[model samples]
Target: MSALLSLRSVSVNFGRGEKALRVVDGVSFDIDVGGTLGLVGESGSGKSVTSLAVLRLIPERLGWSTRGRIEFEGQNLLDLPADKMPEIRGRDIAMIFQEPMSSLNPVMTIGSQISEALFLHGWPNRAKRHARVVEMLRLVGIPDPEGRLGAYPHQFSGGMRQRVMIAMALACSPKLLIADEATTALDVTIQAQVLELMKKIRSDTGTAILMISHDLGVIADICDRVVVMYSGRVVEVADIRSLLQRPAHPYTRGLLESVPRKGQERERLYQVPGSVPMAGSVRQGCPFRARCSVAVDKCAVKMPPMFRFAEDQRAACWVSAEQSNAPVIEDLK
Candidate 1:
């Protein structure tokens, strides 16, 4: 199957002089048409930055560039002309950001905000834009689209605001949707509802999705494939079942172990030791070696190459070639 979106060894950096920093380093992945690929990592792992680079949404002063190509719909996005980017943004790709309150205009009516996407993208008629606004709201499951259209952002609840954001993002029926921590602010129930809605939208429209989140459970539930990120790079990539059942990277294992399970009794939750190295402080080795229990002299001395587990699964770890022999915590204790 051909990829609808592909990132080949992409790198994104920021700052200048002594402050120069590389936030995303040599990361690559591909998402197939109508497939969902989850980018999972702890905070500050460059997942969001990677997504922003794909959308050309990174801050201008930050000085972001990709040494590699971001191919979407058979075109290299990095080489797309500035004038053409806007057409690609709303028509070919869309994003649902983490914060609705900040992303949504404070004074604009919910319906009008969605309509702006249509207008900017050359909808060309007030009647068609109005119809699209209402259709999109209904598509995202907002209640009473006609009445909601007149209501401002402040009038809607957090979940409703997010729905409006989703409605706006889908207003153009983009082929790929990039969701950056889209559920973080919502309560669990609402998060589940939004995710279900996204699944429904995907089924109905055949839209490919790239979902970025720090929550492993969210990814497990919604994504077909998963990519584990660590310190600005991809550490593991696998289908959902294999990833959750038999993660290969030590960082991936740590993430799985860190999540609390039902009826489990332990003194404290397992935590990945040490902080993510500051953007420029990363060394020439496995980025997680500072926290990996399985780290050896080789792990600390050089970055591991990606080892294939199967056709659809791969991980960046020397141990990925063999079953991990590292001692478990129970054995250590």
Candidate 2:
């Protein structure tokens, strides 16, 4: 099966030499047609950087650089000309950025901003573009779409602004959607609404989604597949159900264990001990070695290669990778 989007051992570094900080370290994953792949991790896990690299939004002139390939529909995005990117961006792949307040222009009306993508993507009919904008607003669950056409970013609530951002992203009905913490600002009700809207978009348009978020619940809510990132590296990748039921990587298990479960009681929430390594400090072994409870001396001495557990799931842990072939704690449980 072909992927709608693919990132192959993608590494992102800022600056050069000793000063260089590897923010995104050798990440690999893919979003198949109409599939939603969630990137879940703590802040600074390089999820955003990976997304930015895919969109070619990383500031190279400011010293950011990437190694490996980011492909969309088999085309290498890194090799595309700068002028060609704008076309692919809105028309083929759109992004709902992390920060609505910063991503949306305060000076532009929501309708115009939403309509602009349509127009730029070659929808020249004025009436048709306006109609599409209204439809998008309504699809995103905004009431009185016609009346709110002229409203500016400042006029809408944060949640409403997020909906507008979503509206703009979906205006072109692209093949892929990169949503970074997409519903963070929305109330639970609106969040559910937005998630449903995304699911509908996937079903109706077959748009693959790269959903980046910290919320496991949100990931479980909307994503079919999951990619667990830790300190700029992909520690695990699996189907959402299998991942929740049987996480192979210790970091992934730690994250899931830390989430507040319905029946689980605790005096203190489980915490992955220690902090993530500074991006500047190059580690020879697993990035999570410092915090992993199950980590062995090998974890500190040698970097674990990404070992495949299944066709769709892989993990970068020697013990877990080895355990996949043998009956152990996770399998016994």
Candidate 3:
């Protein structure tokens, strides 16, 4: 399948001059048409920032600047005129933010919030917009959808609120959905329901999804491909099966081992030593070298380029590269 969304060497920086921080460093990946790709990493790994950069949502006044290419459906989003972005944001690409309560307007009825996107995207007929809102609510499994149209956001439960957010996002039938920690605030049951809802939406609409989360379990449940990031840079990319079976990057391995297993309730979960380094703190070499058990001298001298282990798998780790005997495909540094 062709790429629905492609990010090439995308970098996001905050502040300027000597004090500037490179929060998202030269990250590159692709989401195939109608495919699900998961961006998995810790909280400070720049997952959220990268998603925001794609939509040009970064606050320029706050000294945030984005570089590199973000291509969606053959158009480079970075090169698009600023005024043209709003035209594409909801119609072509929509985002489900982490917090539904904060994202949804408390004062406005759920119906109005869902209809807002449709109206902005040129669905000027009020009756049609209301119908679309009801349709979307029903599609997301909201019971008594027509009756709840007038309900405020606070009137709904957390899962219901998230479903409303999803309904609103999909109201315009966007080609790509960027869900950043979409299920993080929900309980396991609700998270599973939301994931299933997303899968159903994709199956029903053929919409490609970019699922961003720190939980590999969530990623495993929903993503076909996984991109493992560390300290703002992508360290590994592989099919979900390959990644779960044999993670190429140390960071990826660490993340998998840290997850609690079904029968390991009594066992202490393995932990990746040390927290993620502050953004831009690792000025040279592999950002994960300090915590990596297998770090070599080469890891300290310079960052390793992505080594192709297979057609669908790549890792930016010297040890993995050496062991696999794969040629360097791309230098991210």
Ranking by TM-score: 3, 2, 1
Model 3 scores what on Cα lDDT? 0.94
Whole-model Cα lDDT of every candidate shown, in order = 0.86, 0.86, 0.94
Candidate 2, superposed: residue stretches over 4 Å from native: 326-333
Tell me the tens digit of each residue's lDDT in model 1 across 3-63: 9998988877786556667788878899999999999998899999999889887775657
Candidate 2, residue 114: how far the Cα is off, in Å? 0.7
User: Could you report the Cα RMSD, in angstroms, for every candidate shown?
Assistant: 5.1, 3.7, 1.2
Best by lDDT: 3
Q: lDDT by residue for model 2 over 1-333, one digit each (tens)? A: 678888887889999998789899877788888889999999888888899899898999999998888889899998888889988988888999877777899899999999999999999999999999999999888999999999999998877888899899999999889999998867888788788888888888788898999999999989999999888888888999889988889998999988987887789898888887865364688788888888899998887877667655778788887777722223200
Compared with the true structure, model 2 gives a TM-score of 0.94
- Clashing pairs for model 1 are none
Between prediction 1 and prediction 3, which has the larger TM-score?
Answer: 3
